[model samples]
Target: MAATVNIRRDVRDSFYRYKMPVLLTKIEGKGNGIKTVFPNMADVARALNRPASYPTKYFGCELGAQATFNDDTERYIVNGAHDQNRMRELLDGFIDRFVLCQSCKNPETELLVSRDGYITADCKACGYHGDIDMRHKLTTFISKNPPKKAGKKGKKGAAGADSIAGQPGQVDGVEDEDNDDDELTRKIREGAEKVMTEEEAARLIAEREKADDWAEEDTSPEAMARRMAALGVSADSSLLAGDGDDDDEAAGPYGEFAAWVSEQKGQDANGLSAAELYKEADARGVTKKPHRLLPVLFPALFDEKVNAELPKYLPVLAKLNTSEKTVKALGGGIEKLVEAYPDTIKAVPKILMTLYQADVMDEDAIRHFATHVSKKYVSKDLSKKVRKAADPILQWLDEADSEEEDEESESE
Candidate 1:
């Protein structure tokens, strides 16, 4: 029997049921033809419930070497001599990104590819459904070639099987054996059930369809280029879809205008002042649509330095908040900033406080924004993430409301 190790390297329990064969590599040939062959890659991939080609491709991407898989002989090869230890370390990174559940750290995740070419994960262990970071190069490959559906399990490879001790080649789906009830698991199931209820299912489906409106529908050359640009990837003609016809249609007036502003700022040594920005908008015939432009412009204007830019642009933002609609637009603009600069998610409370104090957005607008999520500017999931980061400010706002009510009652 080949030596096996825990699927999760950090899991040192001797009896851990999820196991895979320890990596075995052999360096072949010499000079230019020299390569590393993973002898038992099929067994390891079977244990992880992933295609052998995936890890092979991942190794190629990470090592900057050419990886090839021969279907006839089921051979996996990388065109460079790689040590077992180095390959094992890279395997850990693969497990972290593709195998382990984001919420539970279990290896029971199923990759879900959306029609829009995005990859998400569904954890059977903890019922966490979340987007996998699309920034990785491997995601593009995974999205193009999704996993094949498994056949019905036999008794030996059953879902309830606790250990693969004797069957060293069995799949990894070890269920948690602890008898204690997990509150988080219970809540997640409850939430899922609520969404699936007959009365809400239709509404939920409609919302989901609406949310996908902004997602990519086809793999056209222009579409692929736009998606790659949004993901911060350089355009690669070989990897992209469609024939090499370059269609440079703008992503909409709002996004185009924001891009123009960013380009203009980059070209000019001295940044555009608030008045200069207003004048530029006037020249471009976009001053009337500040509501739409503001959301995309907010991030474009400040890049990642919102703290420094917010105060300087407060007067301009204050002037734009002339009505309730405009105030709500400002709130949406802040949400865009959070979406663009995820590190700013933690600073959501401070951002909201700054805008509120400056009268750019009123308390009522801020409270409403905190409670409601819109897919008009960003994805619903990103909106929820931003709100989650604003919990401290939300709680403070609630407490202040309660105190005001108490004071009014005492006066009466």
Candidate 2:
């Protein structure tokens, strides 16, 4: 028996269960006919739960050489005098692409080929099913010559029943089925026998206890925002408050404040009280930070009735918009309002006009909002919609500014 090593050669964990016979190569022929043969290709393929032809063809693709596999002789040959180390590296690449589960990085996965020539890896270890990268040359070959299905068992003494039984000393179709099951069972058994450290045992116990919570899906905006934060993607940071993790405090200056506002609004019949909101904002130390306040406040206070809600919230809005930056943030809040309630898009003109008349937003703020577009508050497409809906108001503002300039020039 050849020496066995971890399926992932890079993982140096001594207790790692998944193992495969190290690839054995023999250089044959001479000069122009020199070739490399993987003598134990069948054993390695069995360990990976993939066809021997896959890695064989993968080498050919990577080396730009012809590869041949004989089903009867179980011989795999690539038309080149490749070194053992180089072949081993290429095999590792093949395993990473075709064998390892994308979700868990485990070797316990089965390739599922669709009729549409798409390959999906179904991971037994993590119960994850994801599409495999179809750009590799092996995908085309696997799609054309898919893995063989195990033979079905019937009543005793029926034809081919012996093959399906996978009895001892059997090397037929039954061998494929039995070998795979044997590999998985051996891995599980080895993993089960390993001595667990106190920390690892405790962690596993905790995970098992909270498994139900982990299974529950959270599609709420706050959940989505936290997920986006984890991926380092930009979103309303204030929406990621109280993620129930250690990093909750890192969400942003206004995250906890926003969460508090959301909680109060949900409990109170009259919604967020202006006096309480001011105190809360001051306690959260964001009253002076209007640039952050407006973005979170708008989403928390108003909904689709923003056109009507604008006046109702005008007093609070006026208190927050104290500077040029806060005024621009107010503009961003309007965009966020439209994003959250797309139906309010047609009401954008009224909303902006109300804010303008109340002096919550100035001419420069409105002009800045009209000229700039960013996905910070809302998608560019939504921003465009909001700007389009507020176009009449924007045009009027531009004309008023032009008339003032004309009057100034005439007075000069």
lDDT of each: 0.62, 0.63
Per-residue lDDT tens digits for candidate 1, residues 244-339, read: 222211234445556556666667725566555654564575545556556656766765667766665654554344455555666677777776
**TM-score, each model?**
0.40, 0.39
- Model 2, 200-272: lDDT tens digits are 7776886887785876756466675664443222445343534323223224556556655655666773655
Error of 2 at 126 (Å): 0.6
Record all residue pairs in model 1 with backbone atoms less than 3 Å apart, i.e. clashing: none
By TM-score, who's the top model here?
Answer: 1
